[model samples]
Target: MTFVVPVHQQGQQQTTSEVGILNNDLSLEREGALGLLERRRNEVVNRDLNTSTTAVQRNQEENGDDENAKKKQQRSQCSRGCKKDWLGDGWCDSACNTEACGFDEGDCLGWCSGDCKPSWEGDGYCDAACYVAACNWDRGDCSRWREQGVDAVERRALQQKLRQFQQHRLQLPECKCERRLLVNGSCTPECNVPECLFDGGECLDMCNAKCSKSWLGDGDCDRECDTPECAYDKGDCASTTNATLQAMRKENGTLEVCDSTCRLWMIGNGVCDKQCNNAACGYDNGDCDNITAVVEIDYSVEPEAVYQFCAKEWIGDGHCDANCYNKPSRWDGGDCEGTEFEVEQAAKGIGPQYDQ
Candidate 1:
């Protein structure tokens, strides 16, 4: 009797197996054929692996030999599904510290030593540390000056304008809220904010001001607590010059009537007003602490016209935001590179032209 058998190789190109005809008595011939086919399969696998390795080498050469690049390569080695849950779970898996991941949800923050938050990619401030391919050329912040086609003259003028704007902004009125207090006499807030220190003990009610210790020395002069029995609001209102309104004392020793605005109109109004970024108004009822960015503001116009620049939705939607521009470590995800206007400039030879 005679038999014919087929041998399959585990390779994509070798889907069809080799066939060998054998005589029942000729076992030696069948063994030789099987061995030959096995060797052929091995060769195909080795070739495929070598080809993949060469492609990787070429990519590395183009990207340069940076630590981030190496980490990016490691991230590529693993599929997203493999590291899905662990990507941003507060544990910097060290293995998943690539930009493709969320920098381990900022858990690996100290590793870079410089600002490399994924959100800080294009926030206008050029981060020297993020000037690499892995970080998308710092999300285009470093090269945006040239890419936007600005000539030396324009660059100088724009820089001057920026400086002036910054100085002017500094002159703007800054409002502060009074710090909350606890039983420990420590200056802190009643909330769970670690940056401000949280008070665990029960609030102490004192001074016959119908208020707790947290409200006695609070910056805002509480009407009920302004009596001398309350030590004139624990001296929080000593400099309040407004005799009639008894308004809150501003940091500059002026009086700011915050009666209606701070309590009703501004707090919980869904706007993170700079004046409300303090304990007096519950930190704008938690709005000021949300993930927000100032994408655009025309300081050339009146400050009132552009006061509400920060918006929570602009941080991660993959668009280069104006507020995030030039701000180191305050990126707009990975969206910004150069401006469309700059691209136009490049065409006119007034600025650097990058290949699209």
Candidate 2:
């Protein structure tokens, strides 16, 4: 029993066979095109390799040729006129003296046995003509006053070395000397010669001539000496009653003065004396709590009496009176017992029994 296909089914089967044949043809064509491309790539690679090898070989051959040519040139030059053996034979022969002979291959670096010419003796040129003894050593020109070496060139070099050595051997004046130590940027007592400017100006003023150690503590205050170099002339300028501060206040026309008292009695009084509130007075012996106001002093009363009066008035006022500082009474009604000033005084081993 054979099964027969319908007419429509038969046409579809025929169309499918044709399509399969066309696909096989396309696959074969694609493979052939790929093979051709691969062959072309291999050809290009092989050709490039060969070309690079050839260029490298050609460059090497060219370099070798150049070297051979240079060698031939040198050989020709060495063989002409002066043989290679005669070039450095220690004799400065006229035949081998040309530049082509390498200047006799440096064989003529020293004195030679050539005839001396009087005209060329002192011409300042170091040649065979002036190298002989009979030329009076080139009339003192070839060696330029340095004639002990093998040649003029070597002598000149030796002269330069001598100059450098002399320069290196030179020494500056020692600062240890009195003359140099005075200006040596440091203060020293040994150099304090008053005749020397300001005793070298270190122990005194560096610029002002008048500010010297000679006038530092002298009874009279030199206005120019009123500087740190002279310790502000403490002998005269320290007290407010001194002439310096008084004159300064008078110049300013202000009777009020900042009391920079150093005396223990003037510090820490109940009154905030203007001059007493400074470090020289132990910060007014710690009495300057309120700097906005300052109590006036009655000039008619004795200073000690005034202090006693002020101490009594400010007692037990929540502050210690400076005048009562470390006093036998430990004044101020014990207000200073726990204060910072009291602690500081205690640290300093100060007490009512100890005198300042």
Candidate 3:
């Protein structure tokens, strides 16, 4: 019988034609090769597109990362009398619990019983480890912290201090130190000042004055202090040694300082002039509420500084004659005495003002 197939139908039949038994494997291989060729062509196109987009996309991603980092940093600081939140409980305290007492239910747990600042608590910036810092104490078991591996003299000194503190504990009007039967003295194992036996004669003060650096007079008490360039209002004395915070020994209540400079106190109204040398300070608003105000200044001399006024009483802001006097530069001829000012730096030219 003769087959009468249409042309389109014939082409369909050819496309759907079955392969011979062994040819099935061959057909699959052939299809795979063709698919591989098409895939290679698509891969070439995709590779070009990927290369073109790589740099731009990478830059965009980097910019996004930087922005994220900046935001994270801003949120990280503890500004509201608290910290950036505790990792577990998210609570903050004023002093940062210098001893990050590992607390569970508001009770000190773990190894330390007292206010032992744990090594991992707070920011851990105060992680003194075995050293045992009182202010910024963190990290490690404070129980193990002590002047260890010392000879007879060193060990005896520690024992002496323990005895002294024990005696001191007895005299406390309040906060009484209870003696535990097992312990020898108060502050059972406290990290008190070192009273080691030093060797040789060392300096007492800078000028061989009172109070040697030596705790035991052996000469090894190393307490080198910083010499202050100027004095603060604390007493106007020249602070030759570096003590963190206190008044100078220069004088008491003189409007003028030996160096005519004042240290910044967070709780006071007295302040210093920040030199306009800071580029960031030029257009800056000098808006200060008591706390954020800048009063402690690094002393500098300039044109405007000469004519500056420290207070209403002070003739000028620390710039005047060596005698700490100033003649009226633009006298309206009013018979008024010159005002006294704190003298950080006295101006030059003692000659009378001819203009006056």
Provide the TM-score for each candidate, comma-separated. Answer: 0.21, 0.23, 0.17
Of the candidates numbered 1 and 3, which has the greater TM-score value? Answer: 1
Q: Whose TM-score is higher: candidate 2's or candidate 3's?
A: 2
**By lDDT, who's the top model here?**
2
Provide backbone clash counts, one per model. Answer: 14, 8, 17
lDDT of 1 at 5: 50
What are the clashing pairs of model 2? 258-275, 259-274, 259-275, 259-276, 260-275, 268-322, 268-323, 269-323
Model 2 Cα shift for residue 329 (angstroms)? 99
- The RMSD (Cα, Å) of candidate 1 is 28.5
List where candidate 2 sits over 4 angstroms from the true fold: 1-3, 79-356
User: What is the per-residue lDDT of model 3 for residues 242-301, given as tens digits with 9 covering 90 to 100?
Assistant: 221233223223312322233222112122234321222211112121212232333344
Between prediction 2 and prediction 3, the one with superior lDDT is 2
State the TM-score for model 2.
Answer: 0.23
